[model samples]
Target: MEIVLKKGTFLVFLCVAILASAQISVKRLNDPAIVAQHKRMTFESWGDWRPYPKYFLGIQTNFAYATVWGMWAPKINRDYKDGDDIRPLKSTGEQNLRFAQLKFQEEEVKKIKAASDTIYKRSVQDLAHWTSATVDADPLWLLYYKRMLKPITEFPDNPQNFMEWRLKDQQTFETLNSTGTLKRLQEELDLIKEKYTWSRTMDMPRGKRFIMFHETLIRWRIFVQELRRYNNRTTLLLDYRSILNSHLPTALPTQWTPTSDKGIVQNVMQQYKHKY
Candidate 1:
């Protein structure tokens, strides 16, 4: 009698559970809003499950001395909105260029500061070691002492002049590298042409020659490179901001989630998938 009663109760509970599930299915089928909200929520949840890049702005800020001030680009299909027009992924070279430029700027700035410090230090050494007549005769040493001793901001009132100085310096190096310019500069000299070469200019003592060709040109090149780099950075930053502001259509259509259909509608489509 006890066994019979337990079997009956179990049957009743199974019936009630089946009925509850049926009621839920019916309500979902009748209510389109519920289905839509479910799909939207599912898609959003999928984004939460998405993996982050191995390295990003947060990594740079926390681990490196550098920080990105510009808008980080988002992958189109991954970071989607209701009608966002997706843009194609940039070419590998173009994609890498962003980080490369940032690193280049950081290193370039460090090099400039180091060069400035060295100039001041060398000037101090020269003043101590050399006679007053010799020290006074060397105008470049005096200039370095004066310039590096002051803060960079205090020394320059005109930005345009500073840029011009950079351009003038670049022109000097290019001119020196031009054909029929440096008779000693041989084509097969086995020197690394891209980077700065001290082998050629190091032995040339710190006088008018060194000031005109080496010190002046190098400083100017730094200024020009960094100035152009920052200007380019400004353009990229503004463009990215504009992209964020606009709700324009992206390149790709929004990907629908698994539940993005009305009730068993997706099941019907799946049945035809193999045949198609």
Candidate 2:
């Protein structure tokens, strides 16, 4: 009798479990709203969040002191919003940025602040002026930097040009809308570039140029490259991966992320480009 009773109870538990699972499946399949919510939640739940990129950003903020702000041209143009251009920033990533900016403790900021304090040291200070003077003197990087950050409308074509994607002014006259002229835009880029005149040191090599600053940028570059690959893979899976899906299709990847303390993303991307 005990054996029979045990069997009956087990059977009832199995039925209940199966029924619950079936109900979940049915609800998800039948309801479009449920599917949309599921997608939204899935979009937000990327892994690796607890510590945030606070340490990373702090390093970049300091590094920007010695680094130049410039534009990056790549597989996509910044003007349109289709194809490989604009990747959706997951909602969780947005939240992480907010949290990092807000609740950092006193000690955390103090540490990063110390590194930056080294900017006033006599050796580094002289070097800073010397370096800035040299870059400021260069019209080529200046021109490149100027036109680089400006919209792709200013560029003739993508780095790997396919005549079809070209945005010649005569062809797309209606699409042209400039809030500022090229001269004004160049001034704006130059002014923004001037803001990073000082940087913090992370053990800072005795005479190293841009030290922690350049290294941090390298790390960010790698990070962004990896994120781009992931974005591309995910995009391929979506039904709409074409340019029409974008609210503002861009041919450029404006921002950057780095990969390591030892090297910049430029170095890494070069190493990996064969595979990319």
Candidate 3:
């Protein structure tokens, strides 16, 4: 009985020792220091660029052969077979311009006039879109609000340092708004009208026709530029108003009007009547 009891005691001790050893091993495996050492060893052996695999030598040999072939192959030009078409190539720009001229002749003044009208209509549409309430609800406005608020919010905590940041924000806002994109668009429209008198007559010399077409192209491009600027200004204005409403609600007037000197903010705020 005593021998049996001794054997049982030995078996229990052995099992406890095995379990304790497994726990220690697991803890060591999970230890940050031990994991870092293993990572260092792995990087030194395989991750580093110096110690490449056995197949890398084969790749190097193949690359050398490819380089030799590329260098020598272009020198061995074969004779062209009969019936192959050979033509002189014009530049891409010249070809495109020639294509445009041909298309212009086919469509003539009607198409160009229609395109000009469409551009004007699109500018009007963009104005309506800009003044809509949807601009305020954009998810990106949250990011803009956070960015604008950071300097102002931090101002009380660190007045001197944050003052510089606040000034920078205000400068950026004013610089962006001062582009006067809408005024530029109106000026461009008047210029287009003045220059477009030639298009109506269409009895000009061949040289004048080309010149007029070039001028028309320039006017169209100017319209595009002005419209882009207008859209940028629209976004900036909306973002500025959002910042103001969040931080300084009373800065804007209660009554917004078309003739009011407040500008785009007055127009946009009209959509939110209750907010004011």
Candidate 4:
């Protein structure tokens, strides 16, 4: 019985010792200091921390300064260091000149914008008037009538040429009666006026402005010339009819010389060119 009890006691002590050793090993492995040391070793193997010494020094310096000042340091004049003094602030001559130049440019832009608005308003009014007038008394229609009265010899001789001429003539006649030159001119004028309404003069190129102005002038000239021609032909017809009626002492036949005098139409047709 004594020998069995001694063997059992020795086995129990050996089991307790093994358990304590395992617990000690686990605690040491999980210790914060040991883990930190391992991480340090891994980082050191990669590179020295000397390259970032300036950054660390700057952080430390800032911390030290903050601790010393504690929000009581001068904040407003902090930009000025010792021995610094304030002097009168005056702009240089060049700066003043530049400022004046900028002011002049701004004023000039204002003047140009005002002028452009005025011109655009006037142009739109003129275009609207012309558009309305053309609707009732289309100069192109009168011109076409005069043209059709001309002899066929005055037109193109070649078949292709004649076809092209007829096509263009038909197109012109249709367009004049439909969305005619006056309507197109009004549309163009309105488009430019709208474009420049919100935009500055400098935004619109000078060349574009000049080209539009030139085109408007040319169309205006053509309209005035055709209107004059129509007026002259109508006046001449009325005068001829009046003279014939006075000499006859009796009212002429309705078919003798209609309001659209065929003789006057034929005579005026010779003076007009085929081109619009």
Q: Clash number for model 1?
A: 6
lDDT against the true structure, per candidate, is 0.43, 0.40, 0.48, 0.46
Q: What is the TM-score of each candidate against the true structure?
A: 0.19, 0.18, 0.25, 0.23
lDDT of 1: 0.43
Give the TM-score (vs. native) of candidate 3.
Answer: 0.25
Instruction: Give the higher-lDDT candidate: 2 or 4.
Output: 4
Candidate 4, residues 52-155, lDDT tens digits: the string is 12236435434433433323336642343222322212233344557788999999999999999999998876664344233224354255422432322243
List model 3 lDDT by residue over 191-212, tens digit each: 6655554443444433454465
Per-residue alpha-carbon lDDT of model 1 for 106-127, expressed as tens digits? Answer: 9999999999999999987765
lDDT comparing candidate 3 with the true structure: 0.48
Query: Taking the tens digit of each residue's C-alpha lDDT, what string does model 2 give over 13-73?
Result: 9999999999998986876544544444445432221112223644533332222211232
CA RMSD, predictions in order: 49.1, 46.4, 36.8, 22.4
Give the winner by TM-score. Answer: 3
Q: Enumerate clash totals for all models, in the order shown.
A: 6, 28, 0, 0
Q: Residue 79 CA error for candidate 4 (Å)?
A: 48
